[model samples]
Target: MFIAIVPAYNEEKRIVTVIEKLEGHVDRIVVIDDSSFDNTVSLARNAGAIVLEHTVNRGQGAALETGHAYARSVGAEFVLHFDGDDQMDPHDIAPALAYMKEKKAQALIGSRRLDEHSTVPWFKRHILLPIGKMINHFFVRERLSDVHNGFRILHKSVLDSIVIEQDKMAHATEIPAKIIAKKIAFVEFPVTFTYHEYGQGTLSGFTIIKDLLFSKFISK
Candidate 1:
């Protein structure tokens, strides 16, 4: 069945809205709480989402891996990574699922860059994102319009093959790199989004680059 895994931090206020909007869109909604200090787990369960938790704050990447693992354990064939911060539209769900089947792809990535209707801040549109695209392209050698959008769909096999080692924001960069290294069939779908300011300033391009360097080069 189709399952959506939402990784959330201290998003008690927004998690309920995200879960409710995803209702009837996917078969199951699983919220992976990254040791959130707030009542995110309780609210997610109250909102009818299957809630999972990390005893420690393992970051977004770890939360996602936990959710994916749980989705697979529950026999989920199609898995979608959704944000719990209420930044994305739940309407993109159906099209992304359909695109996965149409392209016979193992993974489907939603790109805000492809949608004319999407909008973002000037810094993201002209600065951070372009640098991200260039860095991602350097590794994959593919022209991907967007690299950091977390809206993604993956077949169980894709998840099985790709191992997420980064425990934080760098996992966003690591996932696609592993997919490219393994030659997995993935397609980028057009998806619209609204960029919010919450937690947006935590990491910068330099931080991402430093993490990427450590994970891709030094760690190895």
Candidate 2:
């Protein structure tokens, strides 16, 4: 059984499209609403996703843990960690999962390097991307173009092996570190990140900068 775990916080506008896109690919779509004040839960349920609502806003890491636990409890064989902002392309799901199966890898990260059409901002490409790569190389000892990408596939075995300790944005860094520490086979597949004007930078740039620093420095 393949499961897709999408962590959403007040993302009512685009969750429907995200759910609809995963329709045939994923056996079950679990959307964890992280204490959103909006109608995210109702909209997700109406759009055919199994919804899990958190009473308080615990951040993306908490939401993902909730979904991952639920997926494991329900006997999911393979799991896809995704974002609810409609950024990830659903078409990458099958191929990415197939790569993991073929390689017998415990985890497969859908990297954005293969996307030649990405229009990422200059700062992200110039500053953040290199910083992320260096961190992955130095700490995780894995050479990958993208490190903090939220789209990835994991086998149940991998999920079982790693304990997610981070409650916020650090899970982006923590997951890979845990995978490597356990000597799990890790592979990276290129994926495209779609930027919707409505969704891009929905949070403040300063807030994103702060979280990026926290994930990179403080979380480590």
Candidate 3:
């Protein structure tokens, strides 16, 4: 069985649409509400997704870990981690899953480099990208065009082998490191990058830099 695991946090604006997009593509959908203050949980439940909520906001890592555990519990053969903000396009799911089965990979990452102009913020491309590349090259010893993208598909084995401890945004940077450390069989396929309406709020340029510094140097 295939399962979609969505880690959401106060994503009342776009979570429903994301779930709708996943319909018919997977066997079941699991929404891990990270203690969203809004009606995220109720919206997801109403949308026909199994909703699980954290008592308090434990962070993205915890949310994702929770989703993964639930997916495994249900005996999912392939599990996909999709963002609640609709940054990842649902169209890439079929091909990515096909590629995973063809390659027999333990984990599959949907890379966003294929897009001519990545929807990722400019600061992320200029600053965070470099820091991520440096960390991957030095610590992980692998070259990845997109390191922190939330769009990913993986086998239960990889999820079982690795554990995410960083209960924050840094989980994006840390997940690949753990995958590399374990020498898991993983592959990446180019996928589209487009942030949706949820990203309407303007983020200062420094915010990306600050998160990168914290995740790369301090949080680790």
Tell me the lDDT of candidate 2.
0.81
Q: Give candidate 3 misplaced runs (Cα > 4 Å).
A: 115-117, 197-220
What TM-score does candidate 3 reach?
A: 0.86
Query: On a 0 to 1 TM-score scale, where does candidate 1 land against the true structure?
Result: 0.94
- On lDDT, the stronger of 1 and 3 is 1
Tens digit per residue, CA lDDT, model 3, 75-168: 7888898988888888889999998889988888878675554576776666666766666465456888776678888888987888776676
lDDT of each: 0.85, 0.81, 0.80
| TM-score for predicted model 2 compared with the true structure | 0.88
Best by TM-score: 1
**What 10-residue stretch in candidate 1 is worst by lDDT?**
197-206
Q: Can you give the lDDT of residue 79 in candidate 1? A: 90
lDDT of each residue in 34-133, candidate 2, tens digit only:
9999989999999999999999999888888898899779989988998999988898898888888899887988776766756567767776677666
Q: Please give each candidate's TM-score.
A: 0.94, 0.88, 0.86
Kindly indicate the candidate among 1 and 3 with the higher TM-score.
1
